[model samples]
Target: MDNSNSNSNSNNSHEGCYFNRLLEYTSDSVEFYPSFKNSTLFTAGTYQIEQGDTEYKERRKGRLYLFDIEKDNKVKELQSIDFNSGILDMKWTHHNNISQQYENDAPLLGVVMSRGELNVYRLNAADQEQGERRLELVCRNDVSLDPSILTLSLDWRTDNKEIVTSYSDGSLALFDVDGGAVTNRWIAHDYEAWICAYNYHNTSMVFSGGDDCKFKVWDTRTIEAEDGGRSNSSGATPIFTKRCDMGVTSIHCHPALENIVAVGSYDECVRIWDLRSMKQPLTQTDSLGGGVWRIKWSPSDNNHLVTACMGGGFHTLSSEDGTFTDLSIKSSYQGPHQSIAYGVDWSYTNSSSTDKQQYIGCCSFYDRCLSVWTP
Candidate 1:
């Protein structure tokens, strides 16, 4: 939603998107659905402009901003979609009873890009109408198998079919969101795998993180179909792997606690691993000064969790019932989020609001900030 100039009033339909735009670049990701009354936001961003000669490409295309979280929290922008490349992460997928999905389907938006596409948009929003909203385009799904890779992160597999992608080189793809298929492709990580997840309490269990400091676990069933799953140079060898303390980016798998994971690194700590009895970190968090790209868990509150921390900013982790024993760290209104704190989300309201109430939606990067922190 940037470079301003798209909405004439309403009525775009969805072809190349570009409707109701206005979000001017660099604010990497933020997602929250929480709407029965108040919450539905998506914010994505990217930029680069060079053109001609070497081309310098970084902004092939990107713009997805749809906000409306007003309940006194206030966000209200409401419409923009413009996709094609350079977005790098976005997930919403609905039908909450707790997301085993399928109440009839309806809401879905799972994107990842830079050029290695894997899209799926279609926000029925209870059958449109408000400003004649539109995002439509159910599947693009390329997943970049051969070489030209770029898709950074994704994770949807609660029953929304499947999606678990993360790649820059150091691959790991498995998408099949309604058969726009890429079934499985692998490499697992020796370099930039950023993050990959799907273990909303065991969706066959898969999780990864890396710039090559490793923290892995994969067993889609032990993935081995040979070439139909495609490109598997010995793909399934991580029923376990761990060596953190630096480059492990972020990973979150703890919807209602079953293996309970929450890792983040670049050495700025925040581990909470318990994957079948941990190897270390049952709790850790000392330096939240930077480097923890994102880790969010609390769609309905298991104990509460959220963190962005890129230049060290958004933080909140509480522990009690799910029992990590005693863990508490809170820095929610950090001076007003200066920069780098990539993205964060956790706002599914039923509104009993207490236990120090926290409702968040954040985004930042090179000062393209977007925030809404309700208490």
Candidate 2:
């Protein structure tokens, strides 16, 4: 596929919002996890199973692929591993820990499986030079939850040692990598907790959105009981809850700004909220056609964001005027298509010298494809 296209505004406005497809990849199943860190992009491919397919008894596996962003702005496949189960969510640690007197230490990758298993793997440099094309991830720790409950989403703590996961059964869990145990777990919502994330600025605070149409804030410090065991009740009460027009789908905290959060809902709108006051959203974007499934803040810019709309293709949003405009993808084709954009993420590395262009990766559900572009 040609990776170049002219940059043009969606409606000829002055915001200069435009994106061009740079690369594309096809997978066997839907690609759910598209994470970018350092100079590598980590993606997991998962296939959907029929509800009553009794003939397919064997456990299905998935592929974990790694792509490196080259200096010439092209992506090269680095390695791939066939995991035991389909990955629903994956996150790369933010801290590398190499500067903390650890020799040759690379960041950890946390993988959440469809069967409710959580595993942490260390990227070993020793395996990279073994002459084999594929690099093996050294398993550092593995924690399995109740096999009946499926994990939906997960976020890594800034320390790169712990992770918090949301589940299908309206529960939240925190796992410690070094100790290989679940440090805390609680009933967080009344319905499926679709998304959960750590407030990188404050490790004690977590943000979660659920199918209950509520966005909630959780404090881990209060989850402990007075007697030093897990609390029997729901543990701690939510610090705040904001009801939305539809079920909440995604939430992303601002990378640089403290207390600022971007929330996406099935109502087809993205709302920016301030944690100090939950009375109202600071700004809400106009509809982007289909429901907003994913929202990602740019790692390089605090004011920019991108979203994967279920029916709206993909969009680039700006917060310059305290409101969201339709800076969606500009295309010659018109009208609705059947593809559902399920995953979206921004590359941590900038592709342009002036920071005018950055790499973005997105995957579609029905289409079973991954696209790398810039907006």
Top lDDT model = 1
Segments of candidate 2 deviating more than 4 angstroms? 1-40, 50-52, 55-60, 69-74, 95-105, 126-144, 225-235, 321-338, 350-357
lDDT score for candidate 1 against the true structure: 0.69
Model 2 TM-score relative to the real fold: 0.77
Q: Over the stretch 138-243, how does candidate 2's per-residue lDDT look in tens digits?
A: 4533343455567778888887667888888888878776667677778888898889998878888899999999999988887763322232247568889999
Q: In the order shown, what is each candidate's alpha-carbon RMSD? A: 18.8, 6.9
lDDT of 1 by residue, 1-375 (tens): 232332231322323222222246667788875443333445455532324564333436666776654343334565666654568788866432443323344567787877788777776553445553456777786777742577888888877788888887887878777667777787899888999887776788888898888988898877765565667555478888889768888898776667778888888777888876766768887888889899887776678788888887877788866677556774454434567888888766544533333457777766665666653
List the global CA lDDT of all models: 0.69, 0.63
Clashes of each: 3, 0
Residue-level lDDT for 280 in candidate 1 = 75
